[model samples]
Target: MVPERRRLLSRRWFYLLLLLPGLLFALPLAEEDLNAIRSVTDFYGQRAGKRMQAWRELIQRGKQQQWDEKRALTEVNRFFNQMKFLSDVVLWGKNDYWASPMEFIGAGGGDCEDYSIAKYFSLLELGLNDEKLRMVYVKSLTYQQFHMVVAYYPTPAAIPLILDNIDVAIKPATQRKDLVPVFSFNGSHLWLMKERGQGQLAGSSSRLTLWNDLRSRFSSEKLKRPKLNLDD
Candidate 1:
């Protein structure tokens, strides 16, 4: 039923009804999301051509599969994993940096957290409810390092399927014995993942400076699109 209702919502209607007219700030305002894509392209200059093409493909693909959550998840995960896995130190010369989806794509590579963040927003743009998706930070027991991945819950009680760049295959959280989830966050809320199932609120996600900065920039920026010619 949840999926069915989600399917009933058209992408155009979603942008017009939910986004344009000050209805609810449900998903980081569509304009900001679109602008981020442009901003990243502008920053990288010469290197952004490929990223721009990928961006077009991503958006076009999302429109094509907007109603199908499973297909959208599979494709977006695949799209981002193709990027090289570079650490924050190597990519941005920082110990830790939370990149916007466009920034992740613009650079052509990023760390685990960047992959998760980019996938999370891609899913959001594809019309998956924010409540059903999360960016989970986990401790990899195998590597003994902190890692991040996207988690999708079909229902509140159902097990989440992990979308990871490392594996390129979506697997249930229970099946991934190597990853011990520490916490999860979406646009609106944060959670502390427990051993039992699901998780509880940890705190406001606004506490994360990089996250706040990204969101702030997204909200303020504007993107310019090419003019459409109907008569041509």
Candidate 2:
């Protein structure tokens, strides 16, 4: 091979490797999930179909390819942030409602908490460790309302990266001056956060009554997954 062509091929191979995490083959989806998406289309129409199809592809591709953590964060944030923002009252006829990833996509939109919860689950499905992710509840000073966002903690004591639908740009927690974090939780524990960092443990995530109800709905209402958040 010519020197130039050899280097070009090498560079191309390197880029290809970046997209391949482990398995080159795509993951299989259950028939019931496919039926569920069709039902969503029947009720919610083509727009919902589009959202559900895209979400399905995102999970399948993320699972199929070996996406680096940064790529996982970027794609998941971008995918969910595209969802239209709707209040719980407007979307679910409630003061506060938490939707599963399927419900969030099927409805074609949701509140901040929905965005965060969806992103958190998507990453988890892609094989990201639960320890590295949190559903954070913060006060959005910009909007003067309680909000929810997903935070990626690279290390236990590391300054976490904020995955917020409101800002739509993943930045370190220190850079998000407009949000004052009140608390954070994952599938395991909950913490009351101080300004920019995690605080003392409050309790297990099961203590959040809404989250418990949401977990049950994730089974009867949507696709089954290991039982499992808020707005952004």
Local distance difference test scores for all models: 0.70, 0.78
lDDT by residue (72-157, candidate 1, tens digit) is 88877876776667777766767887766656655656789889988887788788999899888899887899999899999989
The sequence of per-residue lDDT tens digits that candidate 2 reaches over residues 53-145 is 666667778766789899999999987876668888877778888988888876657889889989998899888999999999999899999
TM-scores, all candidates, are 0.75, 0.80
- TM match of model 2 to true structure: 0.80
Give the Cα RMSD of candidate 2. 10.9
lDDT measured at residue 79 in model 2 versus the true structure, 0 to 100: 77
Residue pairs in collision within model 2 = 21-66, 112-231, 112-232, 113-230, 113-231, 113-232, 148-231
Best by lDDT: 2
Off by over 4 Å in 1: 1-42, 65-67, 221-232
Which window of 10 residues has the lowest lDDT sum in candidate 1? 223-232
